[model samples]
Target: MTLTAIGLAIAATFAGWVASLGPLPIGEAREVSTTIVDRHGKLLRAYAMADGRWRLPVHAATEVDPTYLKLLFAYEDHRFRSHAGVDPLALGRAAVQLATRGHIVSGGSTITMQLARLMEPRRQRSIHAKLRQMVRAIEIEHDMTKDQILDLYLTLAPYGGNLEGIRAASIAYFGKEPKRLTLSEAALLVALPQSPENRRLDRYPNAARAARDRVLDRMVEDGVVSDADAAAAKAVSVPKLRKPMPILAPHSSDAAMSSVKNKPVVALTLDAPLQQSLETLAHDRAIALGPNISVAILAVDNASGEVLARVGSPDYFDDRRAGQVDMTRAVRSPGSTLKPFIYGMAFEDGFVHPESLIDDRPIRFGSYAPENFDMTFQGTVPVRKALQMSLNVPAVALLDRVGASRLSSRLKQAGADLVLPKDETPGLAMGLGGVGITLQDLVQLYSGLARLGNVRPLREIESRRGEEREPERLLDQVAAWQVGNVLLGTPPPENGVHNRIAFKTGTSYGYRDAWSIGFDGRMTIGVWVGRPDGAPVPGIAGRTAAAPILFDAFARTGKLPSTLPKPPRGTLIASNAKLPLPLRRYRPLGELVRTDGERAPHIQFPIDGSRIDASGGDGMSAAMPVKVAGGVLPITMLVNGVSVGELDNRRQRLVDSPGPGFARLTVIDAKGAADTVVIRIQ
Candidate 1:
């Protein structure tokens, strides 16, 4: 046969043998550690691969430093961009050196070849392995772009032990990302991957430093770095100890991962800086508050309902504190934290006003008689004061009037999981501390108050978009405003600024749980401090324990407290005497019973001190409603002290709204009983 035909046959045989190796394992190369980041892409936490290796994903164009890439190419494969899997000149030089010295001097492998070796690791080096790597390198170069091949190398290259990739090494050694690296840091990372195990920074500092210096020397020789820069880089010492991977928001990270299984990156709605600060605050405060006590904090954006920071526990590894338990979701007695909702319900029902007088004396319902936290009660106080002080009897009385089941239902409508004791229907005692709730739910409810009655569900994962639902109502706009205004006046803890945040404090029975939930126009934060085992901590009241933390959390948000929403229309801004007769005092249905033959007449509608929409857009006065209760038949009505007309058989009348400005309303019955109210008609 001719020599040309023989050569063609040999080449055909070699191509067939190479094709028998099957497809490259690109799927295996794509596997990476799952990382959880904040909304801004800041790392919150990371989990190792199934094989217990820290191999974080990388993007060559954005994540890696340019200097490191330059140094790496100059030292590892100078002709990397120009070569097709291998350099013939470099291989020829290596062959010549090996023949003269009877030893292997260099591998002459390009970056693509190194990537092939990493993707398909061999237990022992041999001619067969080298041949396989060469074939795989050529296949990879044909299939991938230069940048993609660099990205794969960045992700899969080993540093030492279980840490793979430049990111893992940078975080483990320098506690930072690889976006910006010092000259020495870049050099150290470039060198470690060549002989990762023998030159581990933590295990063999001397070997690691020597390898790093050698890389720097090569950069100097190649004119990639000046001699002066190389000298400074070599002067710096290598890291001697590896840091534990970032575990900032462990509980939040775990939750994100579970929700997004198999995702390479899980992004959440958390703020990393705020989260770290709050975690530090919790940890330091927990230590100071005695042992076995853990603190949980949850902050949410009032407008979007996105969770800004969540410290599930003070320390996630503390066995005594049961820190692994996410206390933010743990159900515990809410104590007085539910008082604001009770007041909100009462306001919504129109039976009470903030200025209405309510008795705070000891009260009973069936077998339950609730008392104040201090066991003493003021005889009578304004409803506003009752809520601001978190008085027990007044709240329970209001709850009784508004039905416990309704309050629970309203809260559930707002997306709060209100857990009543087993088989015990929601009752009056729930107003104080009979029900269980979680810090996360509490924060969500307060966020509703900040949003003026409409609540958006709290969201943690950024990618998990919630389906649009009907707007959840915690209270009507006016009622929610009233509740928030009352809470805004709640006395601040010592050293705390007043009226900056609308907050309520609660201590469960026996001091088992201490909670403080607060909100402003922009955000809401809830704090829980207690034993994870539900064991009581004496003297651990909400005001002293959790309220301070809540205040500190707001301060750490790095912005001024946003003001609450403006009062909506129809809101009654009034004093006790100026309120409508029925609204002047809040009396439970039972206490409202009258034994006298007939009660005096009183105005029931057009709440006093309210702004009446008397505009009469059609150019005439709008008929103002005049409703009367407890009056004899055919009562007389007067507007601005001038007689308007007599009431109908229903004892109700419509009077022309005298004009704009203030007006006096009077109702007089046959028995000479009369009632008066002053209001602004506009």
Candidate 2:
């Protein structure tokens, strides 16, 4: 009786020790690959885990093919669903085979046991490790469902070097997902995890084929597959090479990963097919452009402000061109890409009409002299013609009329990060690429024009919540419409259709950057082509280098160019003659001409360097007296470069004061001669 009591005590101790072993490490933290997918859930790019393994997240019940699963179950663990984890019949058969054959025929490790071994990897294979795996397997079965165990196995199973999951193996070997594997592919995948390194298809194709045939033979004997199917699958050739994983939009994927934290999957507002096409387009064009040249393209949906596709560089691996740099966000000279905004600002100021005649002659603002791109001038062209031709002098002149600071502020308000040189303010030179802007900001600004003046911030990540933001105004609706209409008439490149897309081109100083940005009714695309190192590519002009690619990218979007916004309310549709006399022609500020006994127009009151107390002491601005002695009568008065109105008779008038700080007051007469003075308003 004492011996029986001692045996019971030992049994109780053993049970207690087993219970103290605790739960298996099935729920322990394991690194998963960070994946960036497109809007349709297509893989764009994936990063390896911390240990340099490609363990992609898998949903075994849905993401994996059923044939592969059936083959796996048949080959690895037939009673996987029925057994608790350790299949007793299989283990007993393995023991009997070992005894009869005098050698181990099969260890009879179930899929759950394999998963447990993978979770707690051991270097030395021993009986102790096998016993631990069996215990863990039973514990895993108690903790997880069949599907969950299958998923963990699918995720952690090693298929080759640096590839730990079916998804990674499929992408590397077959260049596709494992959603619909062929018979041969399914068999090969089923046989890979047994001895992954030895059966690596890229290194040992013959061994891989032999192992795959074994799986096929077993499946046939088990009646899981027909004899004909097994023979056909075995006859198929094994891949001798491994394909690189998907790396589309590498820059965008990197950016998304940097911004999003702790997430295994990142969904972006990108369309995979479109992104792939544009990346190809960028690569082809960069190759054609010459050595050390790269291209960047960004496409945004006009209505939703979602970035549909973004190609940051021609080739992400090309080191000579600095191809990994995201040129879409690079701050470089914008050339005349900002001209449309200048024209839009002029239209909003009410002093200029599209049909108004303007001289594209040599113009000077202080020490700054602006000239046309061809080193020649077109005298007295209509405002529409001047902008469509992209005349540097005309744009600069209009920018002088529309205060440079105001233009910079307006663009900034609309969400463009304009970079100026150190200690330098916005000037007329900015109209001709003296300042810096990025392709993304440029495209965002153009989207405002397509949206009829409201700028929507571009969104890329799908999980980002929309913030409550005030309407971002790039221009009034009528002004935006006018700018779009003018750009719509800009001539297209050779073999390009006219009036379909409203695009503008710009070549920065010294040809360092070539830019072309365009918009249809639904989308806006911006392109930049140059050496990412900022080295000048001589003779590479925007119209020749960038415009063709722009057209081609729009074509490759697989849709025709949609129409631009229609004329909004209050848009002036009139001829040059029909316009008001004051709006009949544009007159530059400080036009200094003294001919035929007519002195140049000059500002007399509120003189330069003078201070005027125009704030009526109630925190409101009062009228300031303005007097001019000039070459001609009916002189136009302008405060801060925007037309207040034409000064009335007596060559003197009182004008409403502008806001505090320095204000530029100017007067232009009937003869176009003008004068300006800067006064501090208090």
Candidate 2 TM-score, true structure as reference: 0.87
Q: Which stretches of candidate 2 lie over 4 Å from their true place?
A: 1-11, 19-23, 27-29, 92-107, 123-127, 467-471, 591-682
Identify the leading candidate in terms of TM-score: 1
lDDT tens string, model 2, 148-185? 88988998899989998899999999999999899999
lDDT of each: 0.87, 0.88
Error of 1 at 566 (Å): 1.3
> Under the 3 Å rule for N, CA and C atoms, how many clashes does model 1 have?
0
Question: Which runs in model 1 stand beyond 4 Å of their true positions?
Answer: 92-107, 466-470, 591-595, 599-682
Estimate candidate 2's alpha-carbon lDDT, on a 0 to 1 scale: 0.88
